[model samples]
Target: MDTTALLWLIGAAGSGKTATGWAVFRELAAAGVRAAFVDGDQVGMAYPAPPGDRDNEHVKARGLGALWAGYRAAGVQCVVAAGGVGTAATVADFAAQVPGAAMTVVELTVDAAERQARLIGRGSADLVEPAAALAAAFDRAPLTEHRVDTGGRTVDEVARLVLDRVGRPAAGAGPWPPRRFPAPEPIAGERVPLLWVCGATGVGKSTVAFPVFLALLAAGERAAYIDLAQVGWARPEAPGDPGGHLLRARNFGALWRSHRAAGSRVLVVSGSGGGPADMRRYLDAVPDCDPLVVRLDARPDVLAERVLMRSKGIGVELPGDELRGLAGADLDRAVAAAQAEAVRLAADGVGAVHLDTSDRSPEQLAAGIHARLVRRGGGAAAP
Candidate 1:
């Protein structure tokens, strides 16, 4: 009998293992393959839920064993398993337990500080100490593994690496699909193209994205604005802490589902930040879509003015002189940082179009963008 194929992802916290596993599973599913995902955390919490503050090593182990057995019995041809199975001993145990299973162990590595930052941002205070411990554990573990550094990788990019290793074809290898955006009318199609807008905070990305949304709407095209930041903020179960911000951004898959279900022809996704990592997550969230990344640029003064204006329009109560202080100092630093990030993203093969928004209204910028899209045969002529 042919052995089941098992793709095991091992990594420290914040190493993108879970996200990679999920993405791989989705890709296989999309290809009409049967696959299952098994995460240690989810397995540990599967039955007879343990106390929130209690350690259940025995239960976790049993759950893991049962999960492996179930998958094997089910003849699951592909299994994407994610967790910190760091040691050679652990791999051996898995092999013994799941006889005839072809195991490919993937190790996701991230900088210690980055892992720590991600953990803290995810509201996992428990991970702070465990992350350090896990780092040490990984060094001591002797296991041949395929390594993926996720220090700055988005989940989808990391997922692509995994998919490649598992011998899956890369996305977009076949005929191009029709593009769609969220619209009032129903779309009768199997594939839809997606355009994503991403940039750093206060870069007027939304300002640019909204007009494109309106333009598409006016043209009777199906499109929608995917305000990821707003969705992140609106999550009710999110921890009321700073870490919730990153967690929400990473875990906000619902937004993509909503857009896809609405049959949006073009999705203008407003991301929280600009980076390879962010872009990866954005793409994974909205799968099988082409991304048109628009990076808006402006002079420091112009950026500062726009930030101040937005703050005022939102009815935020700042101290009497705080706006001026921020404009003079914080805003300058922010714009510089944003520019650097944009350049970094551009270098990552994001197909970015840079627009200098200085002295240009949103309407003018939209017109320019429309012209470029038309020239590229991606959009219709402006009405």
Candidate 2:
């Protein structure tokens, strides 16, 4: 009898769901408890908004289901999922995706002052009021078997608090090593094609890149897509691991290899290369690969509007990068940075192909890039 379970952490934005959930799962994994961590935002990354799914919760949950199946098959005992899920229907939607696992809902709460402090710390002071509104909504209809107070507590402290109620699981073997996937045997003169979409923030890097990946699949290519930032997320970073680079690199290597082993011949990476060094790290991860870089850009106003839409959409869905921009001055700063990044990328000619996204829909942009990819010998080779 399988006794797999899930700790479903629900909270408003900035409630520490991700930080705490990461801490809890890392703690469990250290003991080789066969645990896996899933960030709702990370798994359900898509573009052009999936028609009627507002928060993208539906897709996020579905993605979780697929990942959970793989994890369970690989001998994982349980999963810790952290996201903003308020209504019973939403919870049910998530639980249905993880069949046979008992779901425990835990809400994380924070007071106004504490929330403000955290928001300000993150340069998202604009979120304080919006977060308060979200908190009020959660309060109006509380959803949780247990509530954990995150105010004035470190992420580990919150994790401990949750563990106090849920109790720790029995330990497994020593710390778990990275799971190996069955890779296809290499052939002489064979190289996988890697398409990396790079750009300024809000330039539609993810939005455009995802559709290209899908188009490749449509063309009968085994394709895999990853958001560079999403994969590298781990807490308690060492000074040398700024922005969790070291951790993300390690994780990215493992994921890329797994995708390769799974017989994917094309890789579409959606990321903004901070510089040559950052890009180099990811390039080194793939073996026998031809890399194609496409940079997406938009006018300043267009970029601002897009960033604001992602940052302030009460229930809007984005490609798993939760912190894009905030409201008010924070938004201004984000837009400025994105705009400046666009100019820099243009001057640097970082991408072999530059696509303007100001007036182009994601689908159109993807089509253009895919055509270019085919020309560059990065698309599915004739088969």
Candidate 3:
């Protein structure tokens, strides 16, 4: 059988169906899997607004069938879609778009408070009307066999779950290649140490890195926050670029050396430090720096809650069921993954520290990391 699947995520606003589905698309893409994501809301814009009924014929002809057909022709194996699909008929409408396609319909749900909070954060004006309709419809509509609660989970975690159900990221497979960077200039300066802050998704890596960057400067040290996410991945690149990690490492090494030549004293970078190879890839970027790896730690529940709340603020409202998954099974998997990676990192015997931020604030986490870096000559003392 051809390895093809279709995932239709149905849910109301703040249910996290769309974002979670999108995450799945990205995950598959990163794995070099031919996948397509059809956003029902975006596609709906091509046609006029629907009438009073959401399940009417006019609304159902939103070109989803045509879209899926196009994707199938292009050799796309997996199709993921999400939007305001509330009825069984709507699910059938979507399925009809791609004949003989393996389809899975998932209903994502969330608590009222979380939905309201997300609606408010996303600037979803007229929340009361949508909230009431969602509540009534959920109660009246027939539940699907696959229902997910998205209350406190990270998008990555949820995406992983969906992919697992679809049997993706084949065993022993690595992620798609890391993004590429251009060669940086060679510069000379005194050797500076690197404070590497890294952990699983939603462990406050970015949140804590910024504060640590600032703290280093406040302590009268020359420091720069090198966010790996923003570095090589932001720009468009060619397909199947395998030299991304090497280029990114060279670029970081050049950037650090240049900064040091200009009197910069320390390097603070946040990114993949899960294992020896990940750490080596980054450390190789700045060859002269002694590396102080700090792995941020948190329980799965805590990590999921943090990631979901952050997503809401950023305008992605997740469902409570999805959050629950994050807090429960998803969270368990995430914690286990992080623990395994930490153990792998420990084999290096580089005095790496795993700091749990489950009960700590970002400020506290930053301060703790800052103290450690200062002691190691990674940066100046916090003022």
Estimate the TM-score of every prediction: 0.41, 0.57, 0.44
When sorted by lDDT, best at the front, the candidate numbers are: 2, 3, 1
Number of the candidate with higher lDDT, 2 or 3: 2
69-149 per-residue lDDT for model 3 (tens digits): 434434455677776676566666666656787877777777787877887777885764676587568768745766677
Q: Note the Cα lDDT for every prediction shown.
A: 0.57, 0.71, 0.61
Query: What TM-score would you give candidate 2 relative to the actual structure?
Result: 0.57
lDDT of model number 3: 0.61
Lowest-lDDT window of 10 residues in candidate 3?
229-238
Q: Candidate 2 lDDT, tens digit per residue, 1-383?
A: 44677888888878999888877888876665767677877655443234566666766676566556545544556678888875678888888877778778889998888888887877788778768887898888887758889987888899999988888877644433343433323333478788899998777777788778888877777667778766643322334545544445445555555455445677788877576676676666565678888888888888888877778653324324544447777777877888898888888778877778888888888887888888887775332
Residue pairs with colliding backbones in model 2 are 183-261, 232-248
> Clash number for every model?
12, 2, 16
For model 1, residues 212-249, the per-residue Cα lDDT tens digits are 76666666665555554433221112223332333333
In model 2, the number of clashes is: 2
lDDT of 1 at 104: 82
Q: Which candidate wins on TM-score? A: 2
Using TM-score as the measure, name the better of candidate 1 and candidate 2. 2
Q: Please list the residue runs of candidate 2 whose C-alpha ends up more than 4 Å from where it truly belongs after superposition.
A: 1-37, 40-164, 167-189, 314-325, 380-383
RMSD to the hidden true structure, all candidates? 18.1, 10.5, 14.6
